[model samples]
Target: MGWSLFRRSRIAPGLPVPGRCGPRRHALATERLLLFTPRTRLDVAAAIAASADAQAQGWLGTKADEVLPDPAVRRALLAWRPAGEDGRRIPRELAEPFTPGPDDPLLLVCVRRSDLGYAGALELQHLAGEMGGWLAPGCRGQGLGAELFRAGLELAHTHLGLATVRAGAETGNTASRRALARAGLVPDQGPRRHTLPDGRVVDAVWHRHDTATPAHCGDHQESPRRRPVTRSGSGHRTS
Candidate 1:
């Protein structure tokens, strides 16, 4: 899994909607994927469904007793839309867009350009300058993991305006570690042990990508400072 650690916070209702004030919703594109801030119930539902896959849940660590919506129902919800409605128009339920506070994590849904299908999700924690993401079962092991995480770096550095972005993975998850490295993140210092949301403990390794220029000894340029890594209950999976 390409999961990272961060404190979780609730997104309060009545926050200024996207495009009205604060940070506007973002959309990013890669050669094979389109990443966008979720704007509709369908978008949210699809992301949840992708994360609920049995293989993904293992690394993502879900509540043991929590029963998610039926897989069939989730797929049906993704296929539903208002009759004769423009596919591009925002629906009534999403009139008040989800807006995260400066410190809150923002989730961007990833879709395959070839079919516009739900491929996975990416999470960006603005305050911590870190990101984590996962791919759907159908999309994993297809070399999409590197692209998914590269998009995360773009979100943190280009869109979110962060100079440094970080990610962590269980030491034994070689696939995820390779994907992070391929996405330009290098090894960094962090806690050797991490607890997954499911309460399992494992050896952990951290990686980071920094866009800031290094400060010279005599120059007055101030290098970017690193933020302390913290554990959270949310987990992320990747190809």
Candidate 2:
């Protein structure tokens, strides 16, 4: 699917329609979504708590009660990677990249551009394979997701040197799937079940996007359908 870029001549126009599709619309100029390094542990916790509360209302997915109090969840949120020896904390350097770390691009927190509030995060553990992301419920509708994701893809390509990245979303998650497709990722298959922190199995769909793929960012035509909600870790996406 593809969309038309809608731009208004500022010199001669009143105001551009907000919904007008644009190609690779940049959300913020600085391109920093708040620091996700280990130093921002408290911020990461707040983000995780907010995401969990948002998930409870079904904006993203269901969160397990077990993870609610665990500090490891915050670590995962901060680094956008799995929790380390501390369980509730992820090393700051690991969130980005360090000399003596795993080759996998660490998970990074996604913050709101305006107030630096924790909006969501992205996780991409495997190269050229599956990656995922999530947002707080309040942050779901404004189109920031697409912008952040585009930036994320660029980061993956630049830092990790990966030519391709993969992702997944539930069939009912219209916003997320649309964000992925708008980011040039393609939907692949049907509902796949995965084990959650609380040992519950939930269904989700798989998607993929390759840097080598000849895709455009303006094509956002996917729609979300209603399905039983599932969880992806405090509603955060892991690579």
Candidate 3:
């Protein structure tokens, strides 16, 4: 519910304590945003509320529907209060600590650095090497999408130790495509027709950013022109 709840624990000065998610890996900060694992049910609720916006839902609602299929269930979720406030407690299963596997997709709650307000969420699917995210209505149209996605690229390459990251956008979604390009993803090949979680079929375009060298044919030696990019930093944090 607060930054303190997600604060890092250190074994000693300059020494981060390692947990199941890894040391100092639960939070990432950018020039304008902070991405971190959800620490409470409220964090997830905030994200749900953000994504429920009509405009955002058109592109992102399917996941929310799957997460809370029943309208009654969703209402209850949004209406639920923190423990001790209203004679109710969050369910144990929902409150249990999160321990994700190495290949699990990373989901980070996004907050604005300027106001510490809930912005939205970012996700990176490791096996697919893809990323996607949405923003709250209040945070949209201010050019933060690119920053949000750049943070995704940072998470993939710098924090998660990924060689490449890819993203897809509906061909007509100029805003999203522009943001992906601004985030340093170059247009790449992918299926022209793609199905959304909501079952809509749409024209899609893929983009990717690669730090790895392209594979060569058999018996071919590496060429200087194809050298992998050298990258190093800890600007992005993760869990």
Candidate 4:
């Protein structure tokens, strides 16, 4: 799971349309975490730090210095935004007030369960196509990663209309691979070398999932598809 937490910025192909599912904005809730919007910048930063710091262990291969906010780094990661809107491409809006179409599905995370002091999140960008997540080292275990994956998968299939889900890990990242295995994704074929900021080539293990496969094993005993996950009832939710 630790190695799986490593996330680098390599782009890949889009996923297929999901099979029949529900509309977007389905909210997921637990006693310790709440999945909705209006998250504070501090919370986002904390989660980001957890994610980047964990990846720095050389498993994800990113430098630990990359965790904090910098105008330059922001510019690079913020490219996910469209070109015209604000032109900055940074995440200006956490969640929109309007209903989501088939293309966009956003997710939020928070500490909710009474016993689990965990705070982390996962966002299925273009839930119909791409899926990415962030984890705080505090919330990395106790089965939270599997929960996050299930939440994202539900969004991908039910709302975004995506049939397949994709994710990647550093070549030797066993922790993340386990998380992916928990979710139901299998290694499609990777060990693909990607150039990093230092001009060094880093190998990665890319994985993929289809309707037949699951993203998490769920409750450890039930079928992967039978796992419990929170979903949005409305079209979407924002902070």
Candidate 5:
């Protein structure tokens, strides 16, 4: 969703928590990408670039209107730590770890395995198990979108111990809706009004995924559902 406004300045970069879903060391491996739990300076740089890049901002609205009013504050928030903690665990005060407790959110960066480049981002929100993400321009339309969503599914269901997850998308963002469906999050009932980071209200469609059912991979029979009108509410930009 709105990856641009998610700043973690108060705490050090987070890694997977020790107990929730076994010992996962800051990384989730997909066939094409590696989703890192975000603990290094390099990761911080890639995440900021992917979120702040001109192309992604077009869809994710990376230019979040609130917070980050100062360039230095924004930079500090995105800046990674000095090198030398790749495999080691360094302690810091944390607001959210990968496997969050109630009221915590998890943020992970998607990286292309071949080139080790940032491809996109995914977020699991505070205690509720809702998810949202985006892919870079170069990574779009290459069937990587489904992979990104699948990585999110693995994190939320297998890693974070959530039984189901919900995601929402703007009406016109068909690519995002496609990815969500491919990841097994099918159409579920919900309202249509969604608020953008810029504060504009737009019609959106909602989808849900349950861990009990497996996603039908390579199935192109389904597309996002078009729903009726409803009351407006604040939500993430999934597409």
Candidate 6:
């Protein structure tokens, strides 16, 4: 079965209209993992925890570190994390969910279905038509990076109705380069120097994937419904 990119009004302006035929949350899946729409405090905690990961903090270009320590930030962050984690096994008393609107381009919590554990997250920028993601420490070294990029491609084209999605990886980040390539993104001219949140400057290589471009792309439009997504380690995608 194909993955659904529908949310049930728990998110934003780009969310399927009240009577739209599609799903509200974009539920993408590959062979071993599922990129489900994040909807609870648990997911937020996981995302936050993932961000705090050494790999993430080191490579992520953008960060909310300054605000992350604030109490209001936690509440707001928790307020957006759908109340609890992404499992039904949790006790109701421990569940803490929240709502979404401006938090468009839903972040799909990368989960390993076999164990129902957080692997990473994939983000969609509705208006900008961009995508980014990261994989957890435990899930690295398994070709999951490509899976994440593929999933992001799906959210960009099939689900978000975007004509193209742009991504950039720091120079020397072989894993990310390989992942983008496996997902069909091709080298494109773009900013060579990128600055990270921690004030580190790294040379960045750019890539682009589009619904209408081919020679520029090694792979073409394939449905994310059945496409396998992959990735791992600290990674970032700049538009």
Q: For all the candidates, what are their Cα RMSDs to the real structure?
A: 9.4, 12.7, 9.9, 14.0, 10.4, 9.4
- Full-model lDDT, candidate 1: 0.62
- Top candidate when judged by TM-score against the true structure: 1
Tell me the tens digit of each residue's lDDT in model 4 across 1-239. Answer: 22122222211111111121123333444323444331334334434444454243344334446555354443333322211222332344532233334333354544434432225556655422445555555455566555566666665554444566666665565666677678677777534665444345556666666784333211121122232322211111000
Tens-digit lDDT track of model 1 for 94-183:
344455444457787877756566787888765566678887767888888898888788766655556777787877777778889888
Using lDDT as the yardstick, the better of models 4 and 5 is 5
Predicted candidate 6 versus true structure: per-residue lDDT over 128-218, tens digit per residue: 5556777766677788888888878766676655667767788787777888898888887766777776677888777778896322111
In order of appearance, the predictions have TM-scores of: 0.72, 0.55, 0.67, 0.53, 0.64, 0.68
Of the two candidates 1 and 6, the one with more favorable TM-score, higher being better, is: 1
lDDT of 5 by residue, 79-111 (tens): 323222234332343223233232334566776
Which scores higher on TM-score, 3 or 6? 6
> Model 4 lDDT vs. the true structure?
0.43
lDDT of each: 0.62, 0.46, 0.59, 0.43, 0.56, 0.57
Let me know the TM-score candidate 3 reaches against the reference structure.
0.67
Off by over 4 Å in 2: 1-35, 54-66, 69-105, 189-191, 213-239
In candidate 4, how many Å is residue 208 off? 1.8
Candidate 1 — which residues are off by over 4 angstroms? 1-22, 64-69, 74-103, 213-239
Residue 213 of model 1, lDDT score = 44
